[model samples]
Target: MNQSPLVIGARSIDVGYFNVKFTLGRPASHGGPAPVGNFPAIAPVLRSGAARHMEGVAQPDGCVVPINGVTYFVGPGAAQRGSGTDARLVKEDYATSDRYLALLRGALWRIAGDAGDAGDAKDVVIRRLGLGLPLNTYFDAAQALRDRAVGEHVVGAGANERRVTVEQARVIVQPQGTIIHFGYTNGGKPLEGVTMVVDPGGGTLDWYLSERTTPYWERSGAYPKAMLACAYAVADRLDPGWRDQPAIVDRIDRAIREQRSSFTVQGQEIQMAEHRPAVEQVLDESIDQMLTAVGKMDDVDHLLFTGGGASVFSARLQKRYPRLKKITRMDVDPIYSNVRGFQVVAEADLASAKGW
Candidate 1:
């Protein structure tokens, strides 16, 4: 009798414009929840003595990693060390950029460190890796992204250097991950009828129409009208000079996510409530465009929302479609919905391959 192939490990990475979310699939013997993590999407190259300076300053939420002979500061506090232009927001070729790889390697390094797999100075082998792309980029860039992700990678530098090998990779439309998560967490069954998933993230507003898990590509699409656009609009209203400040934009992004009435900037409190109209206008327009693109959805049984900007877009969406459902998983934040679902999908495939 032939033996089943051994499944080494699996990982899922969702690198959005605002954050990088990831999960590592643990074996059944581990007997605990999946290991997951996230950090800011900023990955700016470190210059000259910056890395040495970073060593002295405490950065609990950030780390430095070397990719192809260049070092980058990646994560929450990374943006503070670089100019605003360092962040490649709204770039059409973002997925193929070095910063994207920096964020990807940063996540892998953290995961390997947390798993204690990097201490042995050996490669951490991932048998399967799952990734996500905006709906608009899925068809055109998915294959290229997958090719870029699979194979050996050296993350970090010097003593912290860790080798990570991705043997296989899978890329799917970003919003589809949310639905997979909803279906798996709800009842371990696939969805039925016409279900629409709207994922509002930092860079793009992606939506998908599916019938019992089969996607309707004609109706599925993505656009650049999302949280970043709202932030820019808010910045324009608050201060024209603030338009070039990525840090200020980050604060605005957080304030919108928290639904805060006001946010403090340079010791001055800026009332977000006053600028609500500007923010809402952008969201409303995006929703209108999405609705028109998807055509009629009267047959839609469930309308779901997921992503970092979900809370910010929820109220507006609910008023438009009363049946809209929010995808919720016990301890998982909405921002992590896609990455978590990607892990679930990869693990399920591994199980099937192993005849489990």
Candidate 2:
């Protein structure tokens, strides 16, 4: 397919979404050193929230780092109908989809405030969405956008759809490991020189060294490594009511961001600090168990750690062997690591095929 392909780093809403990646430099990789001038000619893609980080470092030369990518806001337009087995139930899922879109608009307004007509009310029907909102503000906002979307004088308004197809993940799946690998990316062969991969994100974590480096985008599985789960699970077990309190998420989030063992929680009424030794012991035991399940050996690992959860778990991973040699950060937010690597692999393959 002669397509102008896309390589996207994720947005904020996608904190736990799939295809996030990890990047590791060769040995002797140093940060904040003078630019080495040997970085492979690759593009960085960001959308929604994550774009701001890339803007701060686009090279001082003003060379316009040549951003060739798309910014997709994957809310609202999620397909309202269930295809294949449940086509007949489309009407059943309509309300669910509408409620979801309403919530998505609420989030959008949260991101892009009342700037103009896109942010205006009155044009759209502000109805009750049944959310436990403090007020029906989003209902008012969504109605405006919905009206503007379908209204007259607005060219291709409805065409700017946000829905996703059931098959939207084709590129995110690995061809192999299908029947056995639940939610595995349907596979395509890896490009040469593509052996290592690290995929990090919220919700789950995953990594692998392929027997052969397939295009990273072509390799997919349920990213089961969750940086948040462990800590929150710890928090939950420690306090059953923790989930009900937003303070716990905030505290854990702070601990993760600062890379500190401690942070404030329980509305600052309590402090949550990791017993690193105990946490790592439990963590290591779990990783070892997962290693067995994924059919990997402890020695001779070519692994990469990529995901939003990478930083959070990396603390415990510090005591393990070859920490300097094997561990890598594909980017600041490890969640975007895999998809970006996958983009590089695909681009490299394309270049090779053309004998460039």
Of the candidates shown, which would achieve the greatest lDDT relative to the real structure? 1
Expressed as tens digits, the lDDT of each residue in 1-356 for candidate 2 is: 13321222111111122111122111233222111111111112222312222456532110111112332122222111111111101121222243323323323222222212353221222111111100112223334433322211110113121211110111222211111111112133332333434333333344444555333322323333354444555565467455334335445645654556566553454344544444455456546544554553433234445444555555555556445355333334243333333333333344455577
Show where candidate 1 strays beyond 4 Å. Answer: 1-8, 27-33, 54-61, 117-122, 320-333
Candidate 2 achieves a global lDDT of 0.31
**How many angstroms is residue 120 displaced in model 1 relative to the true structure, after the best TM-score fit?**
7.9
Instruction: List TM-scores for all candidates, in order.
Output: 0.88, 0.42
For candidate 2, the per-residue lDDT at 193 reads: 37
Give the winner by TM-score.
Answer: 1
lDDT of each: 0.77, 0.31
**What is candidate 2's CA lDDT for residue 94?**
24
Which pairs clash in the backbone of model 1? none
lDDT of 1 at 327: 34
lDDT of candidate 1 at residue 303, scale 0 to 100: 70
lDDT of 1 by residue, 1-24 (tens): 033322356789999888888886
